[model samples]
Target chain A: MKMTHKRRDMLVGLSFIAIWIVGFAALTLYPLIKTFIFSFQDVDITVEGIVTTNIKFENYRALFKFDLNFMDLIRMFVEEIFIYVPIIIVFAMMIAVILNQKIRFKGVFRSIFFLPVIIVSGPVVAELFSQGATTLPLIEQYGILDIVTNTFPESISEPLEKMFSEIIFILWMSGVQILIFLAGLQKIDSSIYEAAAIDGASPWEMFWKITLPSLGNLISINILYSVVTLSSFATNDVLRKIRIDMFSPDEGYGYASAEAVIYLIVILLILGLFGVIYLILRKRSVRMS
Target chain B: MITTWHKIKHKLIGRTITEGILYKVFIYLLLTSIGYIFLFPLLFMLSNSLKDIDDLLSPMVIWIPSKIYLTNFQLAFQTLDYFRTFFVGLSVTLLPAVLQTFIASLIGYGFAKFKFPFKNVLLGLVLLTYIIPPQITMISKYVLFTDLGLTNSAWSIIIPASFGQGLNSALFIFIFYQFFRMLPKTLDDAARIDGANRYYIFFKIAIPLSVPAYVTSLLFAFVWYFNETYIAAIFLGGQVPTLQLNLVSFAQSYTALAAANQHFFSINEGVKNASTILAILPMLIMYFVLQKSFVEGIDKTGFAGGE
Candidate 1:
């Protein structure tokens, strides 16, 4: 009896996918479950095996009450997300539009802008900053720091300086977003623009009516990517603090897992906010058009 | 100057120089300035690496060094044991990167071409991997790896990737799926009509057409693996130091040795700069060499965001 074509295809497909199934089960799914289990327990790893003692909400309580410093860090991270995500999205969109233009040596400019993505790792940036090479020397030479200090109160000036530094870092992080937006821009059919122009659409009108609406999906993707990447970065002191506690002598595994779980929730919450906003904007655009 | 500018502008924009030459100039100016900001770190590293003790002390010395010095590079190279660690890094990175790329391609092809049971669920599971922060899973994984006696070995990195579960493997699969799904079904159908087996079709047709996906997965896998010191520290520990780890540990070792020898020498910023520069040199070179395909890969991988 001839095997059904559907069965044959399914069998072949399963064979190809079998390894990933096993791998994901072992690497991702299993570990995820185990992490959740470990979060509520007092876990100790020895030479022989893992020893898990099921406990109450003590680890989590400690996470919130005494250790982890959850509230302040989470608030700061949320604020940073709110501040940086929009800036990165807008900045990346603007740069991508410029790069997408019929400019000369576009490849050269593309490579230059993309260089940071390849080379800017945590240690490299930390190393550079340690050596007092964080900002351009020209800024120092021009007494920009002095002017800023004089202009603002100390409370405002400190965060202002930090915000300025973060802008540079966020600009660096926008490389991949720029690439994504550029690709999205290229995917828009030129005929749409030609039609708009025939209907006497100004460039400004075209951008508002056509370009922004067309790029709606990409903007959401950029926001999600930026927020997620920003949160997971090793340089993120909140995550770093959790990681440190993970390996530290007193807290060890369980406490870190609790912190990790909380941090994970925080990230998901932020992602959900952006995701919902994206959905609302998409709905509005559809209704308007 | 004004009349010539006006004439050129009128000819070009049909109105004013404000919208023509000035606009173009402003764009170039903006691009150059932002490009400089992006280039600042590398420039800072390079210039600082070449600065001597005297040049470093002189407040006047900034962007360009007064005198170029090779001593820092020489010292960092020696401390890092550049050759030994280079081979270690290559071994750890190359196998995992290549294996994950191949595995991702195969899995991605499966999802794209075949309508099997729970296909959507499986694909959703893959997306779940991307969303789940690695920190939560990392500790449990350490416990698991240690139990399996895979910790502190290159296999800790390579074995997971061999099964298509390496770093950002989900993103790789997403990219491969996007690339493979774009191919016309006629090609697969024609091959099948000729009695080509599924494996043969995948190898001969699908794999061959996926150059962009392959490059995207491979290059990114390699770079992420190379730069990954955190996971390496957790899994490999101190057994095998990849180049980045070596660069990080260089200062501690230097201080220890200097203290042991009772030397008055202090760790200078120049040497630190040199280590960073050298550590990132390979990635920099790879980016420049594969610049065209790299750009295309990045452009293509944007679809990983999905509709």
Candidate 2:
């Protein structure tokens, strides 16, 4: 009876997950394997079906050697992640902290901040940017872009200018991050802060000691979320290029597949790098406290 | 006088528990300014969309339009074929979202409740799927869909979703996983002891208890699907016209319409902005109506801490 009951549990659990297992195998794993294979071959759809010719590393070679803008786009993607992720995480944290306070009309503030997540699609964002709605009029009127360009080297200044121009868009992307942080903030027991206050610890001290430490995991989560959203956003130049190249007769499926594979690898490496850096910092902070 | 000044300052900047009047003022000011940055784009969109050509061109006419101009909206509505595309968009987004949310809940429940072989590894793979951009598998999926005669149809989008491979399906599943995990195992145990089967317990107990999770997941999945232009454009670009896909081709369509009607008015920023607004208007309305669930759902789901 015990053995049959245990067997029943296993069967029931597997049955529940049956759809997902099929989806994983058919949609995700199969396509992933096909893409990997297609990356190595010259693939064409000739109505008879997909025809493949083994091209060795030619697609990858062409990407690195002949594709001038691909490398640049990849660099810009990494740079944007570095610059934008921190800004987003910090801005979100600040807002979450503010919203968690005993303030008036918290709902209204949250609604406004989170509106972007609802309406923000690639086309909508592109339209907004094209119409110059993304940047503040003050930015241009004050010649902040000119000042930044003159102040820093071109490599550093270019991203800074891009950042300043799309500052609001960056803030808009933080809607989900803010919610994540706010949730984390709400979970922190008020009693801890009250106890610290009784011990004569200042708000500033409490923020660093209690608040920041408590939110460390959430910060990493936000980092991951920010990087993924920014990279995969419909308006992202790299993704746009990948989509366009898929149909280009010269590049076709193989080259596009190679590019897609490289992009996946780059994103994974970025996440792994962030994970390591976070682990190291967390360890040091733990030791110090 | 010095004592009085100190007392005033102390009152304005209280220590510890009570935030002083000065601090309260500072907090409000900070919040309002940050809130303005968030609203700036929408405000810009609203203001610009309502402007006539003269208002758009005038340097002085920044925020206020000279008058409420309806021409841009008229042209935009005609170009978008607003109602037809909206329903099409809704069908694709709404159906997929409902299916994805339901399937995600089932998968999430399975992960949360029963001990299965390689469950931990499978869960990790689900997270891995979220990280892998859709671009990687998109081409092959497109080919597969094309082969199955699913391209240029709602099924192209709906089929993947029904199978739990929809837009950000993994995230929805994770949310469900977190929510279901938070439910006490004792509930399931008691149900079983009362001769309730596993399926019965899931439907009767687990599903009923996870309303907040279901709401949060469904709302987000719907929004994400609605705004998903990348896959939608690739899959349903031919026959199925979503509002977003319409907006993507707005300029070209406007040009075509203008040439056909011989209406010599060139497409202006106002027309473009108006169309963009139309594309996002449904989502904006939905957000406003369900503002409470949209905001507080995150808190109730215990989304951040369940790891």
Candidate 3:
């Protein structure tokens, strides 16, 4: 009877996880496997379904083959990382730090900070763009995407528009990060700060030595979450192009697949690089510990 | 002479008077300023949503409208089919949230009460889900649903969650687990000695004692799902009418992003805000109604304690 009951308990847990397995497999696992398979196999997704008899590693090859357009895609991704990431981090950090301070009306400020978490996936992206289009046309008549996007083609007239869409990407996603930071800040023993002050540590020094050092774990999570979240934005040059490709009338979906695979590879590499940096930082932390 | 006198005053009374006064003034000015900064865009959107087409196109309303054009809300409602969307969204959100919370509590109870093998492994797996970005599996999950022929069905949204989302459930499980574990093992021991089975003890003693946690998980689910549309967008593909779908469809109609203006999205954004306010009002209302419980829940849950 005990054995039977043990088996029953095991089955329940197995069944519980199995449900997640199917969801994860269907939503993520299979799509991930299919992306690579479809990338190599010249197949039209909209018409001809997944047939993968033919395969070549050419998609990966062409990604780094180094044409001007290819290089431009690479450059655009980097420029975005440089321009957008810092602005988001700095502004979000500043806002979070300020909000973390002991201020009156804390609850209202907390609500205001968390507002963006609720604003995901709506007409907001488009409205933000159209609003930008008005100003971007004026900016393009001068040239700002040239500075930001790096390759300011005279062909692309709506500089302000592109920047506007990009700004929406940059500005909108800080609520969770602020919360994470606030959580991290709150975790620090108040006595540590009290003692530090009693020992003559300045705010800047304390932030670097005590506060930031302690928040290493959260900072890594914040960075990872922020980066992953940016993947959904329509403004991600690669993702944007791939989406356009998927929706295009005359679908050279093979090429589009190639672009998408290449984009995924690049994203994976970026994530990998971040992971390495985090690992190194974590090791150094361990040594310090 | 004035500067020197000021410096001396700053030195003597500054620590108390200056810091206190400065903190008060700064808190008021700085916090409120930041509050306005955070609030302006939303307020801008709310105001813009109400403007007449003529006003919408004008250089700016920049301030309160001459007349409150309630027509936008009417158009938004009609266009987005807000009534239908609201109810469906409520059910979808409520089911997962409740189920997740309950399961978390049960699982938490198990972890806390019984000495189960691989409990640590199970807990670790639970924590791992919190880190894995949901996007990684989104497309694959959609494909899975497509294969299961559950596409565009509520099951696609509901069933996976019957298992659990790592959101409140996992965290709640830990919270519940911790609280249950912290309870003197004597309670369960005494109940067992009285011939109570695990289920009876769970339902009778363990559960009744976990009201704060129940409320925490309840509110967590309510708030999280109230505005949640990420999976809804992918799973339902926005062809169906959930609240978010209503908003998206509304936004799409009005949007010029699509080659032609659909007018659908424009209509939607207007009513969507009204719905947005409505959708969230319950959460804020819940907070007000259970302000004490909400604060206590946060304390017990340790949700805000650390990263």
For model 1, residues A122-212, the per-residue Cα lDDT tens digits are: 6776676676566766677887778878999975676556556555677888888888888889988999988988887777788788888
Measured by TM-score, how close is model 3 to the native structure? 0.73
* Candidate structures ordered by TM-score, highest first: 2, 1, 3
What is the C-alpha DockQ of each candidate? 0.62, 0.77, 0.21
Tens-place lDDT digits, model 3, residues B159-272? 656655533345566667767776678897899789886778888997888787788777766666555555566566664566555554555553433345344334343454
Stretches of candidate 2 above 4 Å error? B16-18, B262-264
The segments of candidate 3 whose C-alpha lies over 4 angstroms from its true place after superposition are: A1-52, A58-97, A132-172, A232-268, A279-289, B1-4, B7-13, B16-28, B57-60, B100-140, B165-234, B237-239, B251-300, B304-307
> How accurate is chain B of model 2, given as a TM-score from 0 to 1?
0.96
State residue B53's C-alpha deviation in candidate 1, in Å. Answer: 1.0
Clashing pairs in 2: none
Give the alpha carbon lDDT tens digit for every residue of A1-289 in model 3: 9988777656554543454445444444465566555567555344434433454866546545743475576566755554555567666666666666766677777776665554544344445454442132334566655565555444343443344545534556776677667766776798998898789776667777787777777676666566665654533555545545544654334445666656655666766777798789778867874
Docking quality level of the chain pair in candidate 1:
medium
TM-score of each candidate structure, all chains considered together: 0.93, 0.98, 0.73
Q: For model 3, how many clashes?
A: 22
Candidate 3 yields a Cα-based lDDT of: 0.59
The lDDT values for all models are 0.81, 0.89, 0.59
